[model samples]
Target chain A: MNEKNTISVATMKRLPLYLSYLQSLSPDAPVNISATSIAAALKLNEVQVRKDLALVSSGGRPKIGYKTVELIADLESCIGSEVLHEAVLVGTGNLGKALLNYNDFGRYGVHIAIAFDQNPENIGNCVNGKEILPCEQMPQVCAQRGIRLGIISVPQGAAQAVCDEMVKSGITAIWNFAHVKLIVPPGVVVLDEHIGTSLPWLVGHLS
Target chain B: MNEKNTISVATMKRLPLYLSYLQSLSPDAPVNISATSIAAALKLNEVQVRKDLALVSSGGRPKIGYKTVELIADLESCIGSEVLHEAVLVGTGNLGKALLNYNDFGRYGVHIAIAFDQNPENIGNCVNGKEILPCEQMPQVCAQRGIRLGIISVPQGAAQAVCDEMVKSGITAIWNFAHVKLIVPPGVVVLDEHIGTSLPWLVGHLS
Candidate 1:
């Protein structure tokens, strides 16, 4: 939360991936990880990895590379991913259920305390131990819990409405999975995981 | 596919998102969309959007902006997303099932012809009209079908083996959704869709 040098969102988005890769590496002895190894693991250019890491104060040694413990701590604090963030999911669709069932979010400090759905059939149900409540209760629950992150996995048509409700209920950030561009008031950050867009690029490289 | 000035993979990855936004726009008259508008919609910087768009030969007007149709055509051709690419998915897990059920891959020139799973229970099942086969048959099926793009949604432990199988089966590009890093031979592209990593970035912006 410290007001440090502003890091670009692109760089910030990649730091978690780097952290994940570093976490996967077996920590033994000095744990000097080169950017080339990190780049190879994450499918990133080594030069770009070094440049991104340079944004922070820590610099890698010539032969030894970066210290694992220090680099992880720096990145975790830098991205604020170490702090537990309570969040609520707005949809219980297939994608929503997948996200709710995905237990790895805790590693990144994200906890979906509850999920809401407009579908009456899904109300009062539990997914991955998280209760599925009525959509109407979302705003109240979010406001009461002081939840900052609102994840929207509803259909594109319903994404904006859910986003607006989250914003109105004091949610400051949103991780939208829907394919629509949501219009939100200022000071709210919307992180769109456009899972569909990557397919084109993957297909692009084949040719 | 044309041998134009090499575009960065990052830029190539974003072109589909731009095309998606363009596709959503109601093309009325000239449809001159400004970079600022695109940036606001996609949560990108206006300067970055302009710089990215500048990679292509087409330049936008000072105020009139770009022609929507022309931009879409250029991006589609640039990424080769206009042509269909056959792919085989490994792992019939929840994430794999979600991807199989997702019908939007056609828009990005990706078609999941079939899926393979190590789980005996899931081998005979079909998801979203795609048949799920035994993992043992993957290499043969991939080679027979001439599949170039391989999608891996297996768990972290099984991911590398699956990647090796895919590579042996002649798959050049892989779209891995696993939580671990995969090692592949030269000239093989691996696009990792780290679903968990986004949570950290989303939470990061809150602080």
Candidate 2:
């Protein structure tokens, strides 16, 4: 990771999505892509894409745009590529399983290291190529793996405890799906994906 | 619905969440709940609650506070009371099923009208108590049931078409979960809940 060219978590979050969009546009085309094209696909301003890309690199010529493979590789490095990031899932509900089945990670260098479920039936099963670890074994495995990002899909009741345990296990970021508002240490990041809160926002500008 | 007290969809979205938080708290305790307390529960501002509530009534006193139950009822009326809103699910993916199984809506007025799936195998069954209707039946069911809100949980590729169909069916608001930006008519509201974009905002704030 280059200390001089660090990217914000905000920019890192968009990389995978942007990569997916860009991949659809040009499969074997040259890596160089225009900020204008990326902005159009993501529905963001070209200036915004340029500003975000500035955090990563500007080696791509303004005429030729950014090199796709190079820019993606650059993004991975910006988000930390020296090591593979291990992700632990808490709450193997429908969403938990859905994420496990999502196979779009190899290119992004993100992998689901393990899954946790209190259900006795699901605890020993292999899900989406990853073994489902018991809830009791979560802390131990997380510590062993040095996992930094924790994904929470548990019910709202168990969400806070899951978050607390994730933080205690040395996790740095939490991608939360539980409808509960988690209480985390000041530095820990929590992303809420509660469909209820989100759906309305999407429709807010509609009518 | 009272014309003068027409609650904006934005305010309606928060009202149910607010009510849930208020109900989760002590019902017997009559202490005046302040905007700050409501804000803390939902991770919003006191002024937001005050302004949102202002659309309904100027009830909350300066320092003393708002009566929880009374405020909840008032907010409910402003959101909706008589005509129950039935919503059609445009895509039946994990996100769609998660929404179907979502039990929180029973408390609020929103009810799952039906779910539509592109796959024939999924078309005949019910998941989470909602029937999975064929995608072909969307326009008919939507018009028949007078559904106005369409939940777009389809893959990004199918988002635009389903949204267009929903709009043609007279739906004015769309809960768009597909990772694509929609070009919709002025009256049609498309609420974007794509975690890819929103998670960044949260990560940036915490980072």
Candidate 3:
């Protein structure tokens, strides 16, 4: 990883797609795969794919292209796929429970260690094996676990308060599913997963 | 909307964020708001915000900025927020159920009219008032309802098959939560919500 060459967010988002594509290939598939083929299969631009792959791996050969196994390894390492990052989830609602039940997070190197909710009934309840704790215990639990990643699945009204608690507990990165924009201090990275936005975009583009 | 000046996907994604911010403001908030203020509130680049706003609105005035109410309307119209898009959801798993239970989609002009599942136990089951239909009935139900949008929340192995059924049912736009990239016709749009990608990106960026 070269410090000088910063990967753009667009590229970062596509890294997993590329990884998924590579991983999906059969073991008996070609040892070397060209960027053009990869791009074609993924419906991405060839030049863009080449540039994105270059950031993580040494440039592919002129004819032979990238070695499949080596490229996958480079992608996994670059995307931090091998490291199991423990994250705490706030709000054990439908979306939160869905995420907690989602088994694919382990493939991306994330584990929802615990869930916290303000609702009394939700506390002590288990969703996908992880216990949901009271909201009051969030800060202490997160601090004790040294959890830096916080997932906000709380409702719009409660998202900010949950975010504040997460930040106070040393969370630096936030994956916010709530519609509201969070006010975080400098150095805090917030990825707002506004699922609502995509629908409108899709509908607007419909011919 | 001007077809000549096409809005970028990046701009489309940010429109909802801006709308959410504007909506969050109190009724007593100033009638006029500037791109700089919007940028500051959202922690986005001022120039980018101005450029995005320009695409949907008649460019803002030099001193008064934009009329808040009119700007909101322009955004709503541009994003097709006024029209309720009927959509069919495939897979009655946790993610699918979460989406069906999601009330916020109505704000984004989307209504999941029906849900489909292959499991016999899940079929005919109701979630958030909408009943889950058999997967075999998906094509017929979607086609009869004239559904243009389809949400694919099925597991990886089943995603492509569901996508195929969606396309067959006249679904031109797909909100795919599945990890696999669906191969659709040139005009068909697929917006993939790869939730797993964000965590690794967040973890990788952590200091």
Q: Per-residue alpha-carbon lDDT of model 2 for A81-171, expressed as tens digits? A: 4444567888888778877876644333457788998889898898777898878787789778777778898987788888888888888
lDDT of 1 at B134: 90
Candidate 3: residue pairs that collide:
none
User: What would the TM-scores of all predictions be?
Assistant: 0.85, 0.76, 0.95
Against the native complex, each candidate's DockQ, computed on alpha carbons, is: 0.47, 0.28, 0.57
State the lDDT of candidate 2 residue by residue for B123-167, as single tens digits. 889988789988888889988877888888888888889888888
lDDT of 1 at B177: 90
Angstrom error at residue A67, model 2: 8.7
lDDT by residue (tens digit), candidate 3, A1-207: 532126766777788888889999999999999999999999999999999888889948988899999999888787765568789999998999999998777766778999998899999899989999988887898778888899999888888888998899989989999987899999898888877676666776664
In model 3, state the lDDT of residue A171.
Answer: 93
Off by over 4 Å in 3: A2-5, B1-5
Which portions of model 1 miss their true places by more than 4 Å?
A: A1-82, B1-5, B20-44, B51-63, B72-82
CA shift at B7, candidate 2, in angstroms?
8.3
Using lDDT as the yardstick, the better of models 1 and 2 is: 1
RMSD of each: 3.5, 4.8, 2.0
Give lDDT tens digits, candidate 1, residues A53-166: 767536578877788887887777765554788999998877888888888788678888999998999999998899999888877898788898999998777888899998
When summed lDDT is taken over every stretch of 10 residues in candidate 3 chain B, the lowest stretch is B1-10
Interface RMSD of 3: 2.7
